[model samples]
Target: MRAPALSALDIHLFQEGTHSRLHDKLGAHALPAGGVRFAVWAPNAAQVRVIGDWNFWAEGDAMTPRTDGSGIWEADCPQAAPGQAYKYRIVTPSGELLEKADPFAFQSELAPATASRIWAGTHTWADDAWMRARATRNALDAPMAIYEVHAGSWQRENGEFLGYRELAHRLAHYVKDLGFTHVELMPVTEHPFYGSWGYQTTGYFAPTARYGNPEDLMYFVDHLHQQGIGVILDWVPSHFPTDPHGLARFDGTHLYEHADPRQGFHPEWNSAIFNYGRHEVRSFLLSSALYWLDRFHIDGLRVDAVASMLYLDYARGPGQWIPNAHGGRENLEAVHFLQALNRAVYREQPGAFTVAEESTAWPRVSRPTEMGGLGFGMKWNMGWMHDTLRYLREAPVHRRWHHHQLTFSLVYAFTENFVLPLSHDEVVHGKGSLIHKMAGDAWQQFANLRALFGFMWAHPGKKLLFMGGEFGQRREWTHDGELEWWVTGLPGHRGLQQLMRRLNRVLTEEPALHAFDFGPEGFEWIEADDAERSVFAFLRKGPPGTAPILAVSNFTPVPRENHRVGVPLAGAWQELINTDAGEFDGAGWGNLGGARTVPVPSHGRAHSLVLTLPPLSTIYLKGPTRATNA
Candidate 1:
C-alpha cells in the first residue's frame, strides 16, 4: 500500500497556521485501502522513520518530507494495525536520535510506558437529540449547576481506578439525582504523572489511559448526554511538563515551546510554556480543542490557569520575565491566541462553550471577542468564594466586623457571566474541607455551612461545587484517595447533602433565580446594611410577569423573633426552603410554613412581614401570587 498524501489545501492551511482540523491530516490514520498512514511535523529533523511492533522496532519505514517546504513527513505502514504501540524515530540536525510519541495520537500507552497506539475511531454516537436541544439547555439564561469532579478519585473499586465506562453510569446517575445540569471533570487528558492530576499534559488528543481507552471516554460523554447531563472538561494550555518523551525539544529544538527560558518556562509550575506567538502552535492547540468537542461529544471546555497566560509577569519577580512591545505586563501574543481559540471553538461547535478559571479582575472575560474581551461563556468567581469563606471562618461575634465580606460580592457580581465556584482548589493544600472551614461548634458549623449554601444558591450566578462538598467531607481533598463517601451516613452530613439536592432543585425550578444571572435586573437589595445584627435580605426577580422570591440570612447564632422584612407585594409569602428546618438537622425556628404581609412599610416597600429568622440560617420565600394570596 502506498502512503496517502495530504491534499494541496491541507498543506496550505497547515503552513499558514489556520488549520483547525489537523487531526484529519496528521497523526496515524487508518487507510481504508490497506493499513495506516503516519504523519508528523518535524521541520528540523534530518530524517524521520515509523518504528513500531509491526516493524520489530526497526528503522526501515522511512517517511518522505513534503515537497512544498511544509516540513511534514508521511509514510505508509501496511503491517501496522489497530492496538499496536508505535513511536517516531527522528534524526535531528545535531545527529541526535530522538524517540518521540506522535503529538496527535488518538490513544497513548498507559503512563510509565511511553508509546502511542494506532487507534481508528470506532465509537458510534447516540446523542443526536441532545445535540439538537443543547442550544436551549446550555443557554446563558438557563440554570447551570456544575458538579466539579476529579475522575481518578471520584470513585474506586477495590482500591483501584474505575474505567470510564463504569464511571459513566455511576457519575451520571449521581449527578442527575443531585439535580446538577453538568459535570466538570478535572483534566482527563493524558499526563505522565498521576500526582499532577492531568495538569501536566503530554497527549493533547488522547484521554488518560489510566481511566480507560479512547472509546471508553467517548462512552463516558455519550452516557452523560443521554442522561440529560452535560460534560465539561478541564483543558490545560498554559504549560506542559518537561518530559523527554513529551513535546519538549522535539527534533532537538524548541519546536512546541519558546527557546528562551525567560519567555518559555513557567516558574511557579516548573513547566514549559508554549510559544503562542508561533502560528503553528496556535493551530495545534485550536485543533486539540475542537477534537474533543467534535469526537467525544463534550459540551464545553473549562480552560485552566488562564491568569498565567494573560500576563507576562504572572508568578514572576522583577526582571524575571519579558514584556510586550508596549512595555506592559500583558502578553499580546497570548491574547491573540486566546481570542482566535475562542472564536474557532464557538464557530466550529455551536452550543458548546468555553470557561476561564481566571483569578484576576480581567475586564469582560465572559464578553464576546468582538466587544474587546477574551470571549468566554463564563468565568469562575474567585473573589466571591474567598470573601464568603473568609467571613464564614470568623466567629459569630466577630462576623459583624467582616460584614462587607458577604455583601461586597454584589458590588461587582454582574460584571461578567460568573460561576460561583467552591472548587477542589478550596479543599486542598492544607486549606481544609468546607465543613472544617466554618468557625463554631459542630452544630453551628453545620448550620453555617447550610446557610452558606442557601446564600450561594440564592445569589445571582451559576453554581459549581466540588464533589465532596455536597456531603460535607471532613478532611481536605486528596488526589491519591477517593472522597469521603461514608460521611453521608451521618445525620448532619446527610442533611447537608439533602440541602444541596433541594438547592439544585430550586435553582432549576425557579426562573427568578436563574433567568438574569448575568444582569442586575434579577437581583434587588432589600436590606444590605444590617451589619450590626449580621443579617442580609435580598429579592431575586425574574422577567416581567414572574413573581419575586425573597432570600434572608442570619449569620449569628441568636435567633431574631418578629424580624421585619419588606416584600414587593402585599400578600401571603410561602417559605420555600428553610436551612434551619428540622429536616436539615437545624433547630426548627422559622415562619410556620408561610407569612402574610402587613400594610406597615419597611425597606422602602409598601408591605412587610414580621417573621422569626432562624439562627445561622438562610430562608427562601415565594409568594404574592393570585392563587395563594388573592
Candidate 2:
C-alpha cells in the first residue's frame, strides 16, 4: 500500500541528462568527470557497481557509489561515454546481486545485456524544419489513409533484406504511388529476436541488426517526408522481452525491473513489464518516446498492445488476478507514465501524433491532458473493427444489420478521434483475406471486397488499409513468407488493386469523405433500407462549399438501371466512383463522362442523385448542391 513518492533529489537525476537545451552542441552537463559517469536507482540496495566492457567483470571495473539524497547510486567510471557500453549491478538490502542497464541512457551503445560503448553518431538536424513542418501538419480528424507494413518484409528483393537507404528509395515511391497519406511501419527498434514481431524489445535505442545501421532508419524516414508521406513507428514501451542476452538479468540483477514476479514478469507474452514507478525506468521509457519523436523526424507512433500495459491481469486467471487500490484493473503507474510520455512528446515536438492500439475498451484514450486523459492524439477503434467485421461476416447485402452494431462506431467516433483500420491483424494470424470473409464464390468475393471498400470510403471516419489489400491478396498473411504476389497476376486481384487506386483518387477529389476527420457533423445517413431494394446509402458532407458525396451500394447480382440515392442538396450530380467500373474488375455499368440528376421516392425531392448501380457494387454521387435545396 506504500509505494514511495519521488523526493527532491529524485528529480535531480532527470536534470543530469535532459538539462538546459539541445542546441548546436552536446550540453556540458552530459559529461561527468575523468572517463564517463554512470548512475542507477536502487533505493533498498546495500551496494551498487557500474559494469561495462571496460571492466571484464573484474572488481576494479566494478563501480562503487553511496546512495544519494534520492536513493539513487552514482559511479564515476571510465566505461561511460556517448558510445560507451555499460550496465548497473546492485547488491540489494537482502544480499542479492542484481543487474540492469542505465535506464536513462541516451543510446544503448552496446545493449541491455552487453557492456557500454562510446558511440559518436554524427548529427545534422537543425530542428527548425522539423518544427515548422510539424506546426502545419494534418490533425487527428483529417482523412488519414495509413499504409501499415512490416519494415523487414516490405522490401524483400528476392528474399534479400534491404537496408534503410534501399528501402527509403523503394518504400517512398511505393506509398506515394498507392496514394496513401501515411506509412504506419512496424516496430524498427532493435529486438533480440525476429519471431516476436518487435514486441519483445530490449535495445530501446538501437535499430535492429536486421534493418541495417541506425543511420539507415533516418534515411528511410527523411526520404518518406520528401515524398509527402508521414511515417509512424510502432513503439513498444509496455514490456521488454526477457532474454538473458538482452534486458533480462543484465549486469547480474533486475535493476531496471521489479525483482518480484508479481511486478516483473508478463506471463502471457513471456516478457518483463517495466516497473513504471521506478525513476530510472520511467526516464528510460519517456526518453525512448521522445527519442523517436525528436531524432527520427517521425510524424507519429502507434503504441503496441496498450491493453497489456494498462492491465495487471493481462494473462491472469480468475483467482490469480488482483485489482488495484481503486478496485479496477487499471495500472495507475502505467497510466501516469503514459500521460507523461504523451505530454513530453507533444511539448517537445508539437503536432506529433501519439496513438494507442488497445484492443480492450480503455476510456478517454484521445482525451486532452487537462481532462485527466492520457492526451494521446487518437486510439485504434478495435470495437468498430470487430463489430463491422462481424456484421460483414454474417449479414447479406439485402439483410438488415443490427442498427446498433452498424452505428456503434458513431458513439465512439466522437468519444475521441478514431482510425477505422483493417490492419495487418485482419489478414495475419489465420484470419482469411478481407475478400474471402464474404459469403460467395471467388468472383463474388472480389466484388464483395470492392463493395466493402466503397463502404469504407463512404463511412464517416479516418481510414487505414493494410498493404496486400490493395490488390486482393488471396492467402492469409504469414510472417515467415512473403505476400501473395502471384494473386496480383490474376484478373480478380489486379482489379482490386486498381479499385484501391481509384478509391484513393475519389477520396482525395471529394471533400465529404474526409470531412469527418475530427467531428460527428461530417456524416449523415441518406438511406438504410435493405428490404424493397437490395441496397443501402449514406452521405458524407464536409464544411460549406465542400461538395457532399453520396455512396450507394447494391448487394444483389442484378443490374439496377436507376438507383436513387437520397441527397439534401441539388445541382448537376456526377458519378465520382463506381466499384463495377472496368478498372475495378466489374461490368463497368456506369459512364466515365456523364452527370445525372433524378428524384428519390422516399424524400420526394427533385434534382436528387441517381446512378446505374451494377450488381454487387458500390457508387459515389458528387454534385454542387443537395437536391432538397434545389
Candidate 3:
C-alpha cells in the first residue's frame, strides 16, 4: 500500500515525539495537481473513507493505512478542491460508522455545523518592524501592562458581534490611547457552545468563524501589531469538550483521550483530558501551539488551567485517580509535554512567550526547563490577586485585622515572573466587579478602587486588568453584553477612567516602577508595619543610577495630617499621582504640588517628608534628589 508521502524524518519525529510541524503533513493539504491530500490518524478503524462535497458525500474513496503500522490513513483526491466541506468516515470493529471533523482542520463550518472545510490561504503580514522589536518590548525589565479582552463581548455593533476586521481598528485605538502594551484575547478558537466563551474548543486550528474567517483574525492581529500592541492568545491545552464531532471516541476508540475514565475525565469541567502519554498526541498539541505563532503571528500564549494539568489527582478524590510511576500525584507525562511545548515555542518563535495560569504552589513555574522548571515566561500571581481583593473587600475598620493580606504577597512577590491578573475569572460567577468588590459607600468605593489600582501599579510585577474594570464598571462581567461604557460619563466613573489612563502612563514612563520587577532589588519596604493607621508605604527602584519612587497608601477614610514617610535622600519631593486629586473626583487634598524633606531618620532612611495623606487615597512621590524633581 502507498502511504502519504511523509518524509522519513517526519515519521521518526512523530513516533519519537519531537515533531512540532505536523500541520505540513496532516489534515487536508492542497495538492498542486488541482486536488488535495488528506491524512488522519485512526489506528482502530477497520476502514477509513473520505466523504465530502468533491466525492458527492459518498464513501467510495477508501484511504490506505500506512504500511508501517503507524495507524495513519491517507488518500489523494484529485477531484477534491479547496473550500469544499469534508469529514472522515471511519468503519469501526463493531461495524458502526463514526464521522468526525478533521483534528487539524484550518477552517470549519460555523458552529452548529461541524463539517471541516478545505481552506488554503497565506496571510500577507505587514508587521515586520513590530516583529523585530518584540524581543526588546517583551524583555523582563520592560513595561508589560496587558489589557485582557473577550473579543465578542468587548464591543458590538447594533446588538451584533463585530467582525475581527472591525475590532482590529477599534481595539487597537482604545488600547493604544489607554497606554496598554499588550492585548490578551480570550480564546477565539471555534466552539459549539457560545456560553463556553470559546474555552471548550472543538477546533484547535480554526479561528471561530463567529468573527469572520481565519484571514480576518489574521488581519486583526496584524493591525494590532502595526499599532505597536502585542497580541497574546489565551490558549487552553488542558482539556477539550466531548462533542460528538470532536476528538472524543475518534475511530471508535479512545485515540486522543485516555482509555481509563479515571485519568481521562475532568470532573469539574466535564471535559476529556488529552492522553499526554501518547507521542503522537504530544506532537499534535505542540504543532497546535506553533501553528498560532507561525501562521497568525501571535506574540504569546497564556496557557489556561495549568494546575489541572500538573497534578494527576486534580479535582479528584481518593480512588478516582491513578498515581504516577513514582507513586506521586504529579502527572509526569503532562510535565514532559509542557516542557516540550515551551521548548518548541521558544526555539521556533523568536520573541514569543508563554504564561501559565497555575494556581498551586508549583515551584519554579516561570523558571527554565533546563533548570527542572516549567519554562514559562510568566505565571499569574493568583495569590496576590485573591489576597489583595480579599483585603479591599473588608471595611477600613476591619482591614487592620487583615493587614497581613495586603503585605503577604510581598513575601513571595519575586518567586515567579508574576503578572498580577485582574482577569475575567475574578469578576464572574457572583464575585462582583472590581469596583463593587470594594467595601464602602459609593464615594468610598470609588476611592478604594483608585487606591487599589494605584497600589497595584506600584507593586512589583507585570500587570493585567480585565475589560471594563478601568472605567469603574459596576456590573459583573457577562459574556453576553458590552461593558458599562456609559459609566465613563459619570463623574466618579469618569475620574476612575482618567486615573487608570494616567496610572498606565506612570507605569510605562517611570522606569523605577517597571525595571527589575522580578527581583527584590527593585522593591523595598518603607513602612510596612504601619497597620494601626491602615497605611502602607514602599519604595520602587530602577537601575543603579536612576532615582527611586515612594508609594504610600491610606486605606482608612480619615485623613492623616503630618504623615511622616521616610526618604532615601535629602531633597525636594513632588507628588506624581494622588488618587484624591480633584480631577479624579476626590476632595482634592494634596501637598500643594511638592514638599521638602527634613533631616529626620525614619524607617531606616536619613530623611523624611511630613505630608498630608488624603482619606482613602494612595499617592506616588518621586523625590529625595533634585535630579528626579527637575
Candidate 4:
C-alpha cells in the first residue's frame, strides 16, 4: 500500500495526518437535504485543495491535514449540496500542482460539460430485498450468460441517440429472450468522440451524454435488475485518452496528469495516464469505483484495458513510451489504483465485483488485495478466447491446430476467476462477424458458431457473447448502424439467436456450466484429447449432486458413432442439451441416452462414461439419471 520510490519530482508535494484533516475540517462531508457525505484517504500529502469549473479552477485552502497522523489530506466540502462542478488541487512540499477528480464525487462533469448538477442518487430499490439475499460471488447461481454490448452502437434512430431508458426496454427484450443472465455495457462515462469506443475516456464521473444523462443509466440498470438480469458497466480508470475537450487539459493544463511527459502520456493509446503516485489521484479513482457500486447498484465493473493500466509501456511496440519515475517498466500508480479501487468497492459493497479485461500474465487479478494482487473478482480469459478462436478458424480441416491449441485452457482456466469473452471488438473493424469467422458459407457458419458456443458452455468459465453473434450477424459491427435486425429473414441468423437463448437458459439449469466462475473447485478436465478423431471431451462441476454435466464436442465433420468419452463414475448421465438438436438447425447429431455405464480408456486407467456424443455438435450430459431418453 506504500507509494513507489518517489523521484525528486514525485515528492513535490508532501503532507501528514491521514484521517482527521479532511473529516473534521469539512464537517465530515455531511450531505445536506439528503445528499452524500464525501471523504478521501490521501496518506501522503502536506496540503490538499478542491478545484473545479464551478469554483473556476481556483485551488481552495480547504484541504486540511488528517488527524490520524498518517499524512492523509481531509476535505468534506459542502459543495455537492446542489450538485456543482469540482476537482482537486494539492500542493506538495516542492510546489508542484496536481489536479485530480473529486475523490468522493458521485458524478464527474466532462470538460465540454464542465458544469455538473449532482443530485443525491436516492431511490427506492425495492430489490434491496433481493440484493440482501443475493448469493455472494456466485457466478454459477447468478445466471451470467452476459451479452457484451457497446451502448452507442447497440441502437440509434433518426439522428437522435437512444437514451438509457429506451435501451432498457429494447435491450431487455433482446437479452431476456436471448436467454442471457446479464447485459454488460461498455464504458458509458463522458468521453470525447465516438471512435475510441469509450476506452479512451476522460471524464470518470459523468455518464456519456452521447447516450443520455446519469438518471437514464440508473433507470436502465434498474429496469434490467427488475427483469432479473444483472447489469455490468465497463469502467476505465487504467488510463484516460488525451482529448483537449475532456479531462486531458482541464483548467488550462494537463493538471490531472503527471507534469512530466514520461509519466503522463500513453503512446500506444495516445492518452494521458493518471498519476496514481499522487494520493489525491488515488482517492479520486477509488471514489469513482465506489460511486458506481453505491449509486447505480451495478452488479460489477468490467474494467477495460487492465494490461495497459498495469504496464508502463504495454503495446508500445518499440519506442512508443517512457519509463516510470521508479526506473521500472510497470505503471505502479495504476497497480495501486486498481488495488485501492478493489478495496474500497469490496469494503463498500461486499458482493460487488471488479472484473478486469486484462490480456497479460500479471498474476492475482482475483487474489485478495492484502496479498499484493490487483484484487479483481475476475479477469477476462483473453488467452483462452484468442487461442480457441484461432484454432477454430485455422483448422478448417480440423487437423491444422496442435492438440495444445484445442486443450490449452486447462493450463490456466483455473488460474484465476475468468470470464470467456467473445467481445464486440472481435466482430468489427474487419474482424468480421462471429459467424463469418467460420470457414464455411452461411449455414455452415451458423453451425460453426453453434459448435463454438457448445464448446464455450462446456469450457470452465463464465460466458459472454457479443450482441450480434447471437443472431448470426454476417458482417462486422458498425457504430453508426443497427445490428442487422433485418437479417432475421435469414434462417442461419434466427437459428443462431435461438441457440443462444436455449444455451443461456440451459446454462442456468446446469450448475456445471458456470461453477468455475470464481474458484477452482467448479471445473475439472474429464478428457483432454480424442485427437485420433479430432474431438475433445470435458466435464463441468457445479455444486455436488448438482455437479457433473459432461460436455462432449466433436470438432470434425466425420461422424463418430459410439463416441465413448470417459466421464466421472459419479452415476448415470443424461443427454440434457444438444447443439445440433434441429432446434438449432444442426444435423441432429445426438441420440437419446440414459446413464448407462460404459468403460472408456484414457491417459491412465479405464475411465467410465454413460454418454453418447455426436459429431460437430455439443451436448450437455447430466450426471447419472435413472430416467431414459424419451
Root-mean-square deviation of every model: 1.9, 5.0, 1.9, 6.7
Candidate 4 residue lDDT tens string, 433-547: 8876776665566667788898897777788888888878776888776778888767667777778777888888766666555656666666676566666776666665664
Estimate every model's Cα lDDT from 0 to 1: 0.91, 0.69, 0.91, 0.67
Kindly give the stretch of ten consecutive residues in candidate 2 with the minimal lDDT sum. Answer: 20-29
* Selected candidate, larger TM-score, 3 vs 4: 3
Measured with C-alpha atoms, the lDDT of residue 261 in candidate 1 is 88
TM-score of 2: 0.86
Candidate 1: regions farther than 4 A off: 1-4, 625-630
What is the C-alpha local distance difference test score of candidate 3? Answer: 0.91
Which is superior by TM-score, 1 or 4? 1
Clashes of 3: 0
Q: Give the TM-score of candidate 3.
A: 0.98
Ranking of predictions according to lDDT = 1, 3, 2, 4
With candidate 3 superimposed using the best TM-score fit, by how many Å does residue 296's alpha carbon deviate from the native? 0.8
Error of 4 at 519 (Å): 4.9
| Candidate 2 wrong stretches, greater than 4 Å | 1-10, 13-60, 70-118, 123-131, 246-264, 395-405, 531-534, 591-595, 599-601, 604-607, 625-630
Question: Candidate 3: misplaced stretches above 4 Å?
Answer: 1-3, 624-630
| lDDT winner between candidates 3 and 4 | 3
Q: Write the per-residue lDDT of candidate 2 for residues 424-465, one digit (tens) a residue.
A: 888877788777777577777788788888887677667888
**Per-residue error at 392 for model 1, in Å?**
0.6
Q: How far does residue 293 in candidate 3 sit from its true spot (Å)?
A: 1.1
